[model samples]
Target: MEAVHEGEIVDVHALIMSFPASNTGFVVPLPSENQECFLSGLKLLFKQAGGIPLSIRIDNLTPAVKKVRGSEGEAQLTDEFMAFKNHYGFKVQVCNPRSGHEKGNVERKVGYVRYNFFSVPPVIKDFDDLTEQLYQKFLIDRKRMHYRKEAIIEDLWACEQKQLLKLPDNDYSVFKQTTIKFNKYNEFKLDQHLIHVPKAKNYSQLYCITFWNEFKVITNEGEVLLSDARPYMRKRRLIPWKDILKDWVYKPRVVGHSRYREYLPARVREYLLTPSLSLRKQRINEIITLLVQYDMKGINEQFYELISKNDEVVSNPYDVEWSQYDALQPIGGENHEGNH
Candidate 1:
């Protein structure tokens, strides 16, 4: 994590998967898997049942739609995706770009895939072997009755398909995928949002956002992966760093901006680096949450109060304050010694 300061590249990506009562996943693939094929498979599965959902809920995925700007009252839906939705007739809704609770269904799906399949997928060099491995996972492992739900995932999927929305007549090509470039300050523009990435990836192209629509930046060579949304820009808003500012508080000489520090109250700035690591970290995260909850000013004011009581701010008000005893004796020593 310290590499974030040394200007290392940070990548994050979001994964969306599906599971049934079998407690096993119907899909699992590497982050770099072919998105077109994956979406086609999903369309096929939904077709088998009936159609797509009346409304599809997803995290903010660029290929599907640009994030909806709540303040602006709408988002810029990509041209290709607009057509896809028009064809499918499934109204797509996004979770709060930052709120996981809004999309618990998909979150659980991701968990199941990671634990039950991908963690131990049978690997092979050939595509045929890979397909066979996937088939075993879907048919053999995923078909078994679940322990807790006591029902087969296959059965649940069948029912879900029966009620899903239908695919459209026209073919839809997936987004070729896009790259995120961080500015000199190690910040990248995610639509109207501004996100700070590690400086390492500056001017290099190794990051991309996935179709499933969550902020998980991933590197091309698989060296580092992290979770962060593309930031939005709201004028005069000082967003604090989210949960990660703990790393910054203890460093003696710091330079940079964070979601947590951006919105710090004018008064609180003086004390931001004073708190203990854990306490300061928690405070930083809380301020970020508060910034999301209220405006930056409101959150900063709260911060001003949060630390007001324990104002043990060790500022060197006088870097060269002389003790009274030293001040009185120091003048005589040089002169007396020289005379002797």
Candidate 2:
């Protein structure tokens, strides 16, 4: 019981169900069902049929539309229903209350199906599987006129699909929704630590952040996962080794005489907290080489001689301290290896 514009005939094959908009015809994909699945189904229909209706006329099922605005007693809809309408680009024009006249076209269509096609309800299988099967049944076979213009419902649907509204750009990662408040740092936390987001858009909108990849900050505005860690990660921020202390902590960090100065090369220490595995291993080896050289310097001048070759990196030749260490004559000359 739907209206097709002048010169258009009702496409009789849309899935049959008691419609919401105009009790007159079936909703191509059951709109009274789950919003996500229902919209997905409708989009498929256009992909096959070729366009969305300027509007869908229905009988106004409660599940489809909530309440009417202004006409409070008359009709109003829920937020979810409103989102559905906007998403599909449809104007839901409800037919008169209980007036079968509004649905004459689809009424005949549904009855026509029962009389001409299935005497019993289609057998239950997995719902998604069933939908796919039925779609194949109608879209492919019913559309073939056996090769004249080579036209079918699929071509018609492809035409309709081109006219459909664009879907949202970014996918919502199916997050559990939560209300979060920003901290004084002007950043939000999914658990501990900070992550960046559009500062202005905070608190006003809801967020959907993933716990594991805190970098993937999401919002209802259709944002894709982006790394905003740099702005929040300050360089050489002095941290009490105790604050991050744990099994991860080591004797190298016992406050004021921070072992970090001796343990890690300056560049490596700067980025070590969030380093790649290979980089961490490489830095560890570099630190171990320094420790070995420093220990050997105590036993023999050869170690000091070998280490002095790296003076451009480890020491300032212009610094007076290197000359003082050079002046130290051996106290007992046990002379472990070679020249002192």
Per-residue CA lDDT of candidate 2, range 9-123, in tens?
A: 1112235533222221222423123333344455555444444566666666554556533444656665656665676576777766667788776676567555543442332
Local distance difference test, each candidate: 0.47, 0.41
The TM-scores, one per candidate, come to: 0.39, 0.34
lDDT measured at residue 47 in model 1 versus the true structure, 0 to 100: 44
| CA-RMSD of model 1 | 20.1
TM-score leader: 1
Ten contiguous residues minimizing lDDT sum, candidate 1: 1-10
Error of 1 at 309 (Å): 78
How much RMSD separates candidate 2 from the native structure?
A: 24.8
Quote the positional error of residue 243 for candidate 2 in Å.
76
